[model samples]
Target: MTEPRTFTLRDDLKLALELADAADAISRARFTALDLVVTTKPDRTPVTDADQAVERAIRTVLAEQRPGDGILGEEFGTAGSTSRQWIIDPIDGTAGFMRGIPIWATLIALAVDGVPVVGVVSAPALGKRWWASAGAGAWSSDERTPNASPTRLAVSGVDTLAEASISYGSLQQWDQAGHLDEIVSLSRQVWRTRAYGDMWSYMLLAEGHLDMAGEFDLQPYDMAALAPIVQEAGGVFTSIDGKPGPWHGSALATNGLLHDATLAVLNPA
Candidate 1:
C-alpha cells in the first residue's frame, strides 16, 4: 500500500474537532427537544433525526476537505476508497439520548490501514469532549471550564482485579450476548461496577477514574475513536476475546496492568 499523505495528523484532529462541533449542534437540539417520557422503552425517531443530521454534516465537511479519504459512518454507511478512512458514530448512546440521559456523544476517528491514529469524542449534553492522536497525549475539556487548558488523561495504576473498577456498557447487551452470567460473575470479582454505557465509560477509564470497560454489539465507528485515546492514556484496547483493533463487534478496554486478567475473566475456558 502506498503511503497516503492526504492530511497530517493535526489536520485530521482539526477535522474531528469540526465534526464534533457539527454533531454537538445537531445532538443538543434534538436532545433538548426530546419528550423524554419513556412509556415503556425509549422511542428512536428523535435519535434517527439527530443521527442523520450529524452524519450528513460530517460527510459534507469531509467531502470538501478530504475528498480522497474514505468515510464509513454509522448512519450513512461506507463511501470512497482511500486507505485513510474516517469512521464516525454520530451518536454513540442513542438509548441514553432518548431517555434524556447525558451520556451519549459523537465519535470520530481517522483510521489508516485499519488502525485508528486520531480520535475525538464529543458529548455536548455532558459538556465534555475527549480527544487524542497516535502520539499526542489524551486530553479532555470540561464545558464547566472551556477556557482552561485540557487535562491530560491517563489510565489507573490498579494492577489487580480485586482493586479495579469496571464499566460494562449495558446489561441488556450482555444478556443479549448470552453472557449475562459472565458479567454478573465478573462484577462480583471486581472492586466496583457500573453500566456507565457509551463513550463516558471509556472516557472515565482513560481518566484513571475507572479501570475496565467492555461492550458487545458495537460497530467500528463506535470503537475506533475510543481505542487510540485509551491506548494513549496507558490502557489496552482489544476485543472482548482479546483480539487487537476496532474491527471486532465487541470491545474490552482496561488499564494496561489488568487487561489480560479482565480478558481471562470474561473469556474463561
Candidate 2:
C-alpha cells in the first residue's frame, strides 16, 4: 500500500477551494435549473438531489487527489481515515436552495486530528466565497467584483452584549431545544438580532458585520468550515456549552470578547 502524502495547510486549502469550485458548478447549475426533487429524511428535514450530486462530485475529486483522506459529508456517510478528514456540507442550506433562496453554500473543511485547519464556504448564488487556513488570515472574494483582490476578514470589536449584534438560525429551533426563553433574553440584551440563519450568519460574524451568532442542532459538516474562518478572523467558535470544535452538535461563534458572556446566557450554570 502506498503511504499517504502529507500536505501543507496552504496546499490543502487550495485543494479545498478547488473542491468548492467543483461543488459550485453542480449546485449553481441545479439552483438555476430549478429541477429539484426533494425528499424528507428520517430526521424530517428536506434533502434535494443537488445536495447528493454536489457531495458526490466533491468525493470523486477527493478519491482521485487525496485517496487516503477521510470524508464526513451530509449526503453520504463517513469514509476513510479519521486523522485527516474532509468535512463537507455540500449544500448547507438545502431548504433555502430548494426554495430558490440564495443563502445556501457548499462548505468544505480539512480537519486534522479533529481540529479544523482549513475552511472554504462558497456561495455562488450569493456571489461570495470565504476561506482561511490556520495561521493565515481569513479572506473573502466577491463575484460581483471579480477583478478585485480577496479581502481579509475580521470580527467586530463589540465588547458588551448590550453593544453586540447577534444572529441565529430560527426561533423554532431554539424553542424546540427548550432554550427559546434564553434566546429571547439574549435578544433583549443584544444591540440587534436577526435570523440570518445557515452559513451566512457565521460568515457575517467573521467579516465583522455581526458580533455573534449561535444555532442549535448542527452536524460537524455544518460547522467545520465556519469555525476556521471565524477563528482566523480573530473570533472564537465553540459549542453553546463552551466546548471547542464542531463535535458538540450546536454552535456559538463570537468576537472572542463576548464568548463567555454569551455562553452564560445560553448555558448558564
Candidate 3:
C-alpha cells in the first residue's frame, strides 16, 4: 500500500476518537447480552464476541481512512507498516467485561515509530471517554455531565508516597511476576491502595484521582494508549524497571513529582 500523506498529531487524535465511537457502538450493545459468546484464547485469557467485533469495526475504519498505517490489535494481529502503527486493545478488561462489569475499555493509540503521539480510551459502560495528543493536553468527558465541556486533566501534586493514593491492577499479576513483595511493601507506604484492575487504574491515574498505578504482564497494546494520556496529564509512564515505552512487560506510572520516590521504593537497593 502507498503511504498516505503525513497527518498531524491532532488529526490522528481526531480519527482515534472516531474509532472509539464506532467501537463503543458495538461493544456497549453486546455488553451483558445473554447471547454473547465467550471463548478462551491460547493464552488462557477470556475473549468475547464483542471483543472480536469491536476490533473488526475499528480496523474496517482504519483500513478505509488510514490504509498506510499498520495496526497491532489484540484480536487481529499486526499488518502493514510499523512506522505509523495503531496499537489497540479492543477490550482492555475482557474478564470484567465478560462478567458484566463496567470497567472495560477500548484502547486506541497512534504510535509514530515507537512512541505514542495520540491515544483514546473509551469505556461506554462507565459513561466516560478520555483522549490526548502530544502537545495537546489530556481531556475527558462523562455522561453525567452531558451539558458540560470536556475537563482538562492534570496529575495530583502529592510529592511523597505517604501522601499519595495509588492503584495496583492485581496482586496476582505482581505475584506471578515475582514482584509481589515489592508491591505489598510499597502499598504499606502509600496513603491508600486499591486493586482497581486493568485500564481503569491507569485512566484514574491520568485523571489525577489516583497518584500512582503499576502492574505487570502487559502487552504494548495494553499500555500504549495509556502512557500518552498519563504523560500528557503531567504524569510519568515507564516500565517498573524504569524504561520508557510500552514495549516493556510491566508498567509503573506516577504523578511527575513522585516517580523517582516510587521507583526507589520499588527498586530498593
Candidate 4:
C-alpha cells in the first residue's frame, strides 16, 4: 500500500484510534507489574517500562500506517515531516501510573502544520476513551458502553465563575509557575474545585462535568490531544496568557462561555 502525502481529517482520526489500541495493549499489561522498570528522563520525570513500550508500539504502527507523517513522542522525541505530525504522550500521568493509579492514558493527536486536527485519549485502566476530529465533534465511551455508540460531548452551560466547578492540575503547579496568588484568588471565587490532574480534567470539561480546567508547565505532547477534544465539544483551549494552540508552556481550557472571564481572572492585566 502506498502512503498518501496527506490524509483527510477522518482518515487521520481513524489511524489515531488504531494507534491507541496498540498502546492500550502494551500499557494495560504493565500497569502494576511487580517488575515494571522505572527510570528518570534527563528532566527528572519518571518513565516506566510501560511508557516506553507503549510509545514504541504506537510509533511502529504509525510507521506502517502513515509512513510519511512526522512524530513527536515523549519517549522517542521528534522525527520526519512537520507538515503532518503525530504528537503522542505514551502515558500522560506517569507518576500516578507508576503508583497504580488509573489516571494515566495514551494521548494521540494529528497536527496539520501546527494545528491539531485529530485526537484520541485512551485510558484502559479507567475503561474509558475519548476522541475528536476537527469537525466531527467530540465523543466518549466507557467500559459499560464500550461497544455502544459513543456519547457526544458538549461543554457545560455554566457561564459564571461564581457557579463554576473548576479543576486545576495542582496547587503546586501554579506555585511553581510563579502564579500561586492568582490561583488562590481564583479558587476562592469558584463554587467548587478539585485537582483532577492530567488529561482527565480536560476530558471532564469536554464531557460537561466541569466548566474549566487549566494547568502550568506542560509540553506539546501533553496538551495537543486534549485541545481538540475540548474545542470540538464547544469549549476553548489556549495558553494561560490567551495565545492559541498547544505550543505555549501552560494550558487554560474552559467551556466557551466562561473563557474570557477565566482568562481575566488568571491574567489581571
What does candidate 4's lDDT look like per residue over 167-269, in tens digits? 9988889999998888888999999999998999999999999999999999999999999999999999999989999999999999989999888889988
Clashing pairs in 3: none
Assess candidate 3 and give its TM-score to the true structure. 0.97
> Clash number for model 1?
0
Residue by residue across 1-269, what tens digits does model 1's lDDT show? 98745577988898899889988987898885654332232423344667778899999999988889899998778998878999999989877777678889999999999999999999999899999999998999999996899999999999998898999988999999988888898999988998888889899999999999999998899999999999999899999999999998999999999988888888889
The segments of candidate 1 whose C-alpha lies over 4 angstroms from its true place after superposition are 1-5, 34-47
Note the residue pairs that clash in candidate 2.
none
lDDT of the candidates, in the order given:
0.89, 0.94, 0.93, 0.93
Tens digit of lDDT per residue, candidate 3, span 1-269?
A: 96558888878999999999999999999999999999999999889999999999999999999988999999889999758999999999998898889999999999998999999999999999999999989999999999999999999889988999999888889899988889989989999999888888988998889999999999999999999999999999999989999999999999989999889888878
* Deviation from native of the Cα of residue 250 in model 4, angstroms: 0.5
Listed in order, each prediction's TM-score against the native is: 0.92, 0.97, 0.97, 0.97
Candidate topping lDDT = 2
Q: Per lDDT, what order, best first?
A: 2, 4, 3, 1
**On residues 181-247, what C-alpha lDDT tens digit does candidate 2 reach at each position?**
9999899998899999899999999999999999999999999999999999999999988999999
Better by TM-score, candidate 3 or 1: 3
RMSD of each: 3.5, 1.2, 1.4, 1.4
